[model samples]
Target: MSLKIEIHSFSYKKGGIPKDNSGNGGGFAFDCRGILNPGRVEEYKTQTGCDIGVQDYLETKTEMPKFLELVKSITSINIENYLDRGFENLQINFGCTGGQHRSVYAAEKTAEFIREKYPQATVFLQHDEQPQLNSSLINDR
Candidate 1:
């Protein structure tokens, strides 16, 4: 069986978490507002986490690594169980004030991590604020 991880990044102040058809909550929501924001700096204000400079700043200046580790540990367990139960969909969300900086970075990295760690699963990544970049999918299997 193949598992699918749908990762989303959005602005908390804008719409909060995305709701399902039944109006129930969906997935994990990691608030990245507390993390060091590169957006506050003028140099990185327009830049997204996809930039090397922004990525370096976040990895070095913030506790993002530690946060990601915890995310991985928790999600890994759930993923294993989901796979065992033949579940097809899993959604994880990352949110920040702007949804352009920390949340985007975290969502991207988490999707990458999940894809690499679970080669049998497929990972889908989306940035709500920056739809121009288009969504990406990792077919690990």
Candidate 2:
């Protein structure tokens, strides 16, 4: 068989990073805000928690007009590497203020994007709201 792509969606919540919350080193701990949009990330500084504009970090952000460019640069490279090497599965994250709104929407959109971009690959989303990581894509890991 060739390769098959899967799309897993999870609600993303804004936070520093996900820990098992334990100091062990088992779960995920990636900071999506700062990583996806570097210089533009300061927009969150004044806000105490979860600014909705984060979704538009791409459509907005005048100075760094390439929000998707930055996101893809950080994520796609890693995704492609796994695929090129013939990995069976991969999981990716897209975090927003709350798992309810922007993050959820973006996660769905991202899953769609990945499915279309890499038809042969399996794309999955693990938003912050997920009680556990990779509830669906867990097997891939």
Candidate 3:
């Protein structure tokens, strides 16, 4: 099946501090920091050595474990019903207080999770209120 997913990659301006209790699969809190300030490219590269945000927040456990679970649940639902599915399209949305900071970072991490678990599937990133890329995705033409 032609699988497709939409994953929004955001920065720090819209999404406020992310919370863990957003779903029923409640788990321990962990900060999956997705910080990559281009201003300090050299330093950041030296600190982590990996370009992907996944390597940056190499913490013991992620604070937003529920986010990961949420994604897993989606995949599980589809896989359970094998041939029944035609084209799998999942939009794992991550909404912090705004749409930046933790939410954006979490979204990135979530994308990685989905890719690893559900390979050979399409993924897309959609930020609701991205202050960085202001291209007017909300306007009437």
Cα-based RMSD of candidate 2: 8.1
What lDDT tens digits, residue by residue, belong to model 2 across residues 75-138? 6775677678765544444454444333344455555666667666654455456444335552
For model 3, what is the error of residue 124's alpha carbon versus the real structure, in angstroms, after optimal superposition?
A: 1.4
Looking at model 3, which ten-residue stretch has the lowest summed lDDT? 22-31
TM for candidate 1 is: 0.90
Question: For candidate 1, lDDT tens digit of each residue in 1-141?
Answer: 587778888899887876543233566778888898999988999898778888999999999999889989999998999899988778888999988889999988998888878878888787888786454435432
Between prediction 1 and prediction 3, the one with superior lDDT is 1
User: Each prediction's TM-score against the native?
Assistant: 0.90, 0.47, 0.47
The lDDT leader among the candidates is 1
- Kindly report which residue stretches of model 3 are placed more than 4 angstroms away from their true locations once superposed: 9-62, 79-84, 131-141
- Per-model lDDT: 0.83, 0.45, 0.45
Return the TM-score for candidate 2, rounded to 2 decimals.
0.47
Report how far off residue 141 is in candidate 1 (Å): 14
